[model samples]
Target: MATAVVGGRLESELVRDGSDRTKGLSRRTVLGTIAWSSLLSACTSPMTSSGETPAANALATPAAGQTLGSGSVRIALIIPASANGNAGAIATGLRNAADLALREFKGADLQILIKDDRGTPEGARAAAGEAIQEGARLILGPLFAPSVSAAAGVARPAGVPIIAFSTDTSVAERGVYLLSFLPQSDVERIVSFAGMRGRHAIAALLPANGYGTVVEAALQKYASASNSRVITIQRYQLDRVSMQVQAEAILPVLQRKEADTLLLPDAGDAAPFLAQYLASKNIRQGDIQILGSGQWDDPRILAEPALRGAWYPGPDRAAYSAFAARYQAAFGAPPVRTASLGYDAVSLAAGLAARYGQQAFTAQTIANPNGFLGVDGAFRFLPDGINQRGLAVYEVGTGTATQIDPAPRTFSRTM
Candidate 1:
């Protein structure tokens, strides 16, 4: 069941002087008295997080001599320390969202603490401890699976819950909850859509990496469950030479009528190269529909003429125009995948906190079945803490992304 909290009431008191005012007090005396009165008033007034009046559900004011200023609530944001990686971008996005949330709840007196894990397990553990020592009640991230594992050891015992950004479901346990966009879900959606379109036989050109391996496994599992056939699966190193060799090797398979669908698990950066190779083989877009992961949202993919009609699953950008505009105004660039995810994560946490108070940081709260609505769309947490997203499918056309598939709905058993 979801947890709930009650908001505290504000009280006002007036102070009076015992002395008679038959003769008006001197200017100096009046000034001194006013200064002291103002100070006393400030001391008695309740403190707030965002500097606004408290909401109906705001936490009660702490007793006298307790932690000053509405009892500090710290949130640790553990992310890669590097400033140039995807993880880094996600971290920045989370921070930005948190800042916005804090601004909205100024009266709550919420304190958001941040820590960098440098994308290492050891660093994550150290950062988690530091946040605890600094009195953090909740943790926001450790963007990698290994980092989540390392931080979980420290956070679980303290009863501090974590909203991690790791994609690996295995890392979720105890008080840790994942807030990532799992590639498996994206693949499943793509495959199911392809199957519905009567494109059964499948082939893949994936990188020889952990992500690639996961995609391969997911494809096999979905194909079996969906009663589809996998005609060929090709692996390629990310380097130029290996990509060329792998493309050439797959050309023969592409010639087969059975291999009517091709899945590329790589991101947008690799699209142009793959498109060039596919064009050389005279494989037009409509002849064999190309399926891709959400990573294809990168603008670079649109530059490739051969990528037209290429389909991939991703969040609906049209629904978040305000967020996109504000983000661009602040960061001087449009929102990318990382930025959108980050905004959603922060908004989710803020909503949870507003609802649950102390219970907001609990594992059960993070994994609440109802889940949280985000800027991207509605998403729910599985038992393992990975977010089950309902993503939208888009097609590349004329150097732009166009929505082709209908918006996803909550998966009901009856459906």
Candidate 2:
């Protein structure tokens, strides 16, 4: 027998159990880690090494009022449950992760009102409005970029803080925090690491989309700061023809050895095919170091022979491994890339409510200079809603990735 806390009521139903806890997380990092050791006792996100799975019937996507937990404080969990394809699948994983978090943190003192965003701005707006009207003090999701923006419109003026899951930095703002793995942070980590290895003069083949735009800006900003120059950049739309055409455009520069590092800031086959294409043109891997954004965290992509020795950034694998094992046991499927955001957000909220009570979601608490160490790694929200994390660097090898640079354990007071 299992009980679910859906809003003000705790229904005796079925759910999942627990798993081992992880000390670190994935998502972001800067050069400096926070040194706020003294703050760990009071406001830091709490962790436990051991957890057991809860046994109960789980819903793939709750239509509404997935009301979880019977705690006094109210919080909202918004996701795109009605969206087509991947968005809906990710929504289920996020909800399960949030439920798993509440189970692990037995002391959590909040009721979660889960709302479906229908994967649209209007849907998210309605969900956010309903949740706030239900007395939600904080909002946890609405995964897509548009949905995050829509929810923020409602949450911001209501004094409700949101820890959204979108990676698009454009939607991030004063009260809307993004907890997804951002492309900009990945660019900074990979480029700076490459600079340390003396592989500067950067060149890139990026997508002609919003994600690509953010990556190019990050590359330019970091390249300028580090005295490195991006000798060339080419953008392509989605489709093999466009990708092939763009990669060919950059072949001349690669053949001339004008760039010491080639940044393939895309995920999936784009990075692999481009690397293979460049190799076929006789641009030896040793001559031009291949760099990738966190999007390269995919195992199959990392293990590609064409991408072997390429470097990228990611959250700690061990923590994700631990978390994934538990999630797999409970949900019976591997988590979506950004699923950890749901777990971390719920865990952090629980800790704040338990410790600081009503003052938990305040800017100061959420933006603790030291940042909170969670399932993905050490991450802290900024007033601008751009989350900073301590990200680890990895190199692709034979069917696996090796950590070349460990993530920072703490944060400095700088940000």
Candidate 3:
């Protein structure tokens, strides 16, 4: 029955309303119960001691969100939850993940305010404004790149830190951290691996878009660092026709054998066709080692016979499979690959908030060099707010992909 005003609009319209926003007596009872159960775990937590630093093993269990308490930290989750698009399913998975984290960890004092960004920048801006006005200390969402940019415009000035889901490095800066699996990281890993394996000369046939441009730049950067060279770079429009044309354009280079490795980072079923077209040009996998980006992790890519022996960089599937099993048991459905992002973000916020209190969201603490171990692997936030994840290299095999290299369990001092 209480109405809150934000930006001349009723807060109820922007933030969540109705019985979903539970607090007060019910919250207190839950907290009291969890407090008794996790008293030992709380005391033993790395967050409890100033000298003790959290390691990969410390993050293995729910540390901070496990017990309910007062002076709750309000977190705003801005994602597309409406019924109109595919995001509804993803949003359900994300919400389910956050709920599961809370239930398992005892996040009684953590109040999650869900807001629908409607998959638009304007909607994201409005939702962010509502979040800040409603006392949200941290914002977690606005999945798309444009939406993240729009939401950041509002939250940054309000001094609210955002952990967005977009992989766009261009949108990440200062307080707006991106939790998505960046292409640059994938490129760096796979390229470095290739260079170490004696496939130094790299050539990429990338799509003509922002993602492709980033991949190309990443290839150049990582290649130079790894004592490798980017032989040639070709761009395509990312359609069937354009793929064929680009494949043909790069055929001459392939024939000349100037490049030892070929990078095809397209998503969906494009990799098959590109490989098929290149094979038609008498270019076999034996002549040049094929490489893919994280996007090629899809199981559908395994069906492509030409992609056999192709290498790609991606999250440790073993770690993800464990989380997926837990998610399915909780939600009665499989979560999208990105569902961990939401869970990790909320859990991190809850843990840090409980650990450092008001100083949890500051740049100093959030970008700890030790990093945080996530469901996928160990990841750290850089000063620029780009998350660097430790990923593994996968080799496409007969009807499957196997991890050729395991993702590092702990953060290396240099990396």
Leading candidate by lDDT: 2
Q: Best candidate, TM-score-wise?
A: 2
Q: How would you encode candidate 1's per-residue C-alpha lDDT over 1-415 as one tens digit per residue?
A: 0011000000000001111111110011000011121211111122234455444333221111122223345566676645333445445555554444344332434566667776677888998998888888877777666778889998888878887766666776657777666777778878888888888889888887667777888899887667688988889887878887888888888877668889985764565787678888897678888988876766677667888888887766654655554444444444444444555555555555555677766667666665444555556676666666667778888768887775454444100
Clashes of 1: 11
Give the candidates in order of lDDT, highest first: 2, 3, 1
- Summing lDDT over every window of 10 consecutive residues in candidate 1, give the lowest-scoring window: 6-15
lDDT tens per residue, model 3, 1-415? 1122211112232234211110010000011111121221222111212333333222121111222223378888887776344455566657766655554454335777778777678888998998788788888887777788899999988899999877667788989998777777888888888887899988889878666777888888889998998888889885889888888888888999998899988776778889988988888777899999776756678778888999987777655666665566555566665677776776677667766787878888777766776666667889998988777788998878888877764566322
lDDT of each: 0.61, 0.73, 0.69
**CA shift of 30, model 3, Å:** 22
Model 1 global lDDT (CA atoms, 0 to 1): 0.61
At residue 356, give the lDDT of candidate 3: 70
1-415, model 2: which lDDT tens digit per residue? Answer: 1121111011111012111122233432111123532222222222222444433333346567779888999999998776665566667878877877776665678799999988778999999999999999999987767778778888888999998877667778888888876777778778888888898799998888666777889899988767789999999887788988998999889888899999987766778888887788887567789998765766567678988888888777777767766666666666765567787788788877876787978988777766777766777777888887777888889877889898877665211
TM-score of 1: 0.74
**319, model 1: CA deviation in Å?**
3.9
**lDDT: worst 10-residue window of model 2:** 6-15
* CA RMSD of all predictions: 17.4, 8.2, 10.9
